[model samples]
Target: MFLNRKVELSLLENLHAEGKPKLILLYGKRRVGKTELLNEFARRHRALYLVARQEAYEGQLKKMSSEIAEFFDDDVLRHSPFQNYDALFIYLAQKETPVLFDEFPYLVEANRDLPSILQEYWDRYFSKKKTFLVLCGSSIAMMESLLGYKSPLYGRRTEQILLEPLKFREACEFFPQLEQEDKVLAYAVLGGTPAYLLEFDYGKPLLENIRDRILQKNTFLYQDTMFVLQQELTEPRVYYSIINSIAKGNTRLGEIMNDTGLEKSKITKYLSVLKDLHIIERRVPVTEKSPESSKKGIYLLKDNYFKFWFRFVFENAEYIEQGRQEKLIGDKISPVLNNFAGFAYEEIVLEYLKSSPGFPDYIFGRWWDKEEEIDVVGLDSSQNRIIFGEVKWKALTEKEARQTLNQLVEKSVEVKWGENLKSGEIQEGPEKKYMLVGKKVGGKKRLLGDGYLVLELDDLVEN
Candidate 1:
C-alpha cells in the first residue's frame, strides 16, 4: 500500500535529523494519502499523533484536554489551570515530542482565531520549547491561506509539504500481475489517488472492479465526486454544472458558460475554484510564451476519476437510477471510454518520460495549429535538446509505426524553437533528438538514426 512515498519519508527523516522540533504544514486534496503518510511517519519516529476533531471550540478543547491528559499521564487537566490556548501550549511546550494537528482546517473552522492563538504560543513558547508541531489538512484553500504571508501562522511553519498523487508507474507497483496496458487503463480511470487504487481487487478483473466498486449503486466512490464538491462549496449546483459541462467536452470558456447556463464572469470564479481543487485544468498551445496571458486557451477536467464520473455517472443519473445502468454505459460511456483510453495512453507516455533516464529540464506538451499533435515533448533547455514523442493506442505493425513516426517528425517542425535559437546554433546543443512512444513500435532503431529512440509499453516499463 505504501508504494511511492520514499521521497516523502526521506523528507520527514531529514527534518527529524535536524534535531529541531520543526513546525510543518502538510496539505493536499482528500484521499491523496496525507493522513496515511502522516501516520506512517509518526509510527516510524514514535511521534505523538493527535487528530483534531472538527467540532465546536469547547468540544475540541475537551477532547484535546483528554488526549493531553492521557499523553502526559496527568490528572490535573480535568481541573487544569490552562485558561486559553496559550496556557494549553505552555503545558505542551514542556515536552520534546511531535504534535500533529490532523485536519487542522477543521479545528480552524471550529475556532477561526486558532491560527492567531497558535502563532502567539509558537513565537512565545513552542519555538523555544523545540516541540515539533505538524498541521495537516485536506482543504487546499485553508492550507494555502494558513501559510500565506497575510495569515497569523504565516512565518511560523518551518516546512510545508504539498503531497500530490502517486505517479502512473508508482501505482503499477500495486498490481504486479497486471499488464502495462491494463495499468495504464487503471491509471486513466482511478488516477494516482492512493485510496482509489487500493480499493481495486487485484484478484478480480479490472473492468469488473470498475463496474462493481466504482459504478455500483451506493458504492463509496460512486458519488465521491459530488461529496467532495458539496463539502467544499456552498453553491454546489453551479460548480457541478460547470464541472459537468467541462466533463462533457465544452472546453472553450464561452462554451462552458453557455452549457452551464452561468454568466461568463461568474464562470471565471467557478473555474478558479475547480482549478484550485486540481479537478479541472486550463491549457493553451505550447508555442505560447505566456500561457496565462493568452486568451485562446481551453479548459478540461484534469482528474481522471472525476472526468469519468461526471461524463458517465452524473450526466446519465436518470438512466442509471431507472435500472438501465448497463445499457446506458454501453450506449454512451463505452464510446467515450474508448476515446478516453487513447488519450490516457498518451499521458502514460509523458508520465514514463518524467521519471526516465536523461531526465529533461522542461517537458512541453505539443499541440499544433491543426488536429495534428504530438503526445509528449521532452526539452532539455540546459542542453538545447528536444525529444519529440508519438503515442498511439491501436495495434501497430512495423509499417504502421513507421508512418506514425514520420508524422511525429513532421509535427515536431511546427514548434519554432528553431527560430528562437541562433541562426546556426541550437539552444544548448547542435542537434535535437526524437523519441517515439506508442502502443506499437517496431524497427525504429533501424529506420531512424541513433538520435531516435522508439519506445513501446514494455520499453517504457523497462526504462
Candidate 2:
C-alpha cells in the first residue's frame, strides 16, 4: 500500500518541475518504500522507468538497450544494442522525458567504472541536453559514496534524497482501526518498516498477528532481518555480535569490545560503517557543549525493527526451529512486551516534539549527569528556552503527574544551559518549561492549566 509518501512524491515533483538538466539521486535501505514511491511519482508523468539486474556489463547494457528500445519502439537499436555508456546516454539525452533507474547500484556493481562513465556523459552530452535522469539504489554506503567529495558524480547531482523509514506517527497509518494502545504495540514490534508492516494482518489480534506473521517459518518477516543484513554486510555474523552486544545494554565502545571480544580500534571502525548503513547511531547528551568531542556518546540501534528483532527473534531462534512458538511467546515476549513498548513510547514522544514543541529552533534529546535522568530535553537557542520532560508508557493520575513534574523541576536546576545565565551575565534567567507525556494522563486539562505542556496518546496520534 502507498501510504505517507506524499511528501517524498512532492519532492520528486518539485525537482522535476525545475525543467532543466536534472540528475536526481534517490537512495535508502531496503523495504523503505523507495520503489513504491518512485512508481507512484512515475504515474503522474510519462517517465521511462528501468530496474537494473546483477549480470555481466555487456548484459546490463543490452538489457537497458532493450528497455529503451521498447520505450521508443526503435527497430534499428532493437536489432543492435548500444556498444557503450555513451550510446545509451546519448539516446536518452535526445528527449526531455523523466527517467528513473531503480536499483542503479546493480548496474554499477556489474560495471565498476559506471560512475566515471556516467559523469563523463553527463558533463558532455546529457547536461547540454535537457536529459532528466535518476539513479536509485538500496546500497546506503555505495550510494552515499557517490556524493562524497572524491567521487566522480559528486557535484553533478542537482538533487539527492536519502529516504528513511516512516516515523512512529506515519507508521500508525497502516493500522487505522487499532486502539491507541494496540497501535503503539504494533508500531513497537514492527517499527516503521513499510514492508514489515504489510506482513501483519490487521484484523487479527496483535499476538496472533505476531505469531502468524513473524513466528512462522514460512513467513516473509521470519528471516527478513537476517536477510537484510546478509545483503548489506560481507561479514554479517561479526556485525550481528556487535548488534547483540548493544541490545544487551552495551552502550559504551569498551563494553561492546569486551562483550564481542573484538579489539577497540576494529570495533570503532565497524561501528562507523554501521552508522553509515543506518543500522546504529551514536548519541550524546543534548546538553553537551561540544557533542562530537563529548567523550560521553552512546550507541543505539537507529531502527526499531532491528531492536525488536534482536531482542526477541534473534535470541529465541531455537523456539521457531523446534516449533515452540507458544512457549516462546508465553515465556519470552509476553512477559517483557510492555517493557519493550516503553522505549517505543519514548521514540514517539521524541518524534512528536520535533514539530509540536513550539520551539522556533531547538535540539531534542534525553539527558543525564550521574544520578538524575530526564526522559526528554529540548533546548531552544533562538529564545533561550529550555524544556525538561518526563515520559511514561503507563497511565498516570493528576497527583502522580504533579509529583513527576515537581521532580523534573528539581532536576531542571541541575541542567546548565546558556553561558550567560549561569554567570549572571543576564539578570533574568532563561525560560524553563516542564512537559510530560504518557499513554494516558488523567486531568490533562488541569495539567495544561497548571502551565505545563502535557500530551497523551490520543493527542499524539490525532496530530
Candidate 3:
C-alpha cells in the first residue's frame, strides 16, 4: 500500500545520517498517510514510535511509558510506569535512539505544557545525544502552530515535512489493472489521500466500488470527510454549508453567500480557515498580478474527494440510505462523472508540468478573462513564453483537437503576459505554446507533426 514516498524516506535517512539530535515536525491532514510514512521509516531504522490517543494526561503517560519500557526492556519502569511526561522524556533522552510521536497533538492536548517540556528536555538532554526526536500529527492547524513564534517548540525543529496526498502517477500505482480513464475517475472519487485510495476496490466495477465504499452508511470512506472536518474545525456544520455551496457550483463569493445565506464577512473567515486546513482553495486568473487582492478570485473545494462527496454522495444521501445506488448512479453520478473527472485530469496535467517541467514555465494555473478560459496555463515571463492548454476528459479526434487548439489560440490573444518586454524593435506578442490533453487523443502524432503539443492519458501514464 505504500506506493511512492522514496523522496520522503530519503530525506529522513539523510537526517539520520547527519548523526545529530534532530527534532523533526511531520504533519498533514488526517488519512494523508503521516503515520504510515513514520511506520515505514521506523521499521527500517528501529526508531521508537508511539501513537498518542485522546485520554487523560496520566493515562497518556501510562500507555506511552509501557511502550517505552517494553522497548527498552526495563522491568521496573514496565511495572511502575513513568510518573509524568517529564520523567518519561528524561529517561528516553538518556538514549540516542530516535523517538517519534505520531499524533503529537494528542499529547499536547492532554498536557498543554508538553511542548515546553519537550523544549526543555530537547535542549537539556537530547541535544547532546543523536536522538532524532520526530513529532508528527494529523491536525494541520495545531501541527503548524508548533513552529509558530508563540509556541515553545518554535526554532527547535531541525527538519519539518508537510506530508501531502499522493500525486497522479503515485496514485496510479494503486490501480494497475484499470484503464487510464477508470484510473482518473477513481482518483477523482478517492483523491490522492492514501487512506481513501486504499478503500476503493478497483477490481470491482468502478460504480460498484463507489457504491460500496462511499455511499454505504458507516463505511470508513463514507464517514472520513466528516471526520476530517470535525477534527479540524470547532464549527464543522458552518464550514459544511460553505463547502457545500462551493461544491454546488457557487464559485463566486457572492454566489456562495446567496446559496448558503451566510454573511460575506463570516464566509470569508471560514474560507480562510478551510484554506489553511487545505480542504478548500481560492483561485484567481493565472494572469493576475496580485492574486490575493484580485476581485475575480473564486472559491473551490480543492480536495478532490471533498468536491466529489459534497456534490454527489452528500446531496444524494437519502437515496444512498435507501440503497438505490444503482439508480443514483444512472440518474446522478454517471452522467456528470466525465465532467467531474475533467477537473482532476486538469490538475494532473498541471502537476505533471510542474514536476517535469518541459520548459522554463514557472507560474502555472488555470486562466480566465471575461468569457475566455483556459484549463491550464503556464507562464515563463523571463523567456516571454506563455503556454495555454485545454484538457478534456473524453477522447478527441484530430479534427476535434485541432478545433479545440484553434479556439485556445484565439483565446490566448486576450491573456497578456510580457507587457514590459514590449519595445519598438521587438514588436511581437509573447511566444505562445498551445497544448491539448485528453483521455485518448486521436492522431496525436499528426498533431505533433503540425507543431502542436498533444498529450494522451496513456502518454502521461508512461511518465
- Backbone clash numbers for all candidates listed: 1, 0, 0
* Candidate 3 local lDDT, 1-463, one digit each (tens): 5667878988999999999879999998888888878899889989999999999999989999889888889999988888887888878877878888999999899899999988998889887788898999998899999989999988988888999888888888888888878888888888888888888777899888887888888899888889888888999899888898899888988999999999989988999999998888789987788788989899888789999999998888889888898888999999988888888888888888787756545688888866677898888878777778999888898889999999887777666555533212246766667899988888999888988888888878777
**Predictions in order: lDDT:** 0.77, 0.87, 0.85
Winner on lDDT between 2 and 3 is 2
Off by over 4 Å in 2: 420-428
Candidate 2 or 1, higher lDDT: 2
lDDT of 2 by residue, 79-119 (tens): 99999987887777777778899999898898888899899
TM-score of model 1 relative to the true fold? 0.92
TM-scores for all predictions:
0.92, 0.96, 0.96
Q: Rank the candidates by lDDT, best first.
A: 2, 3, 1
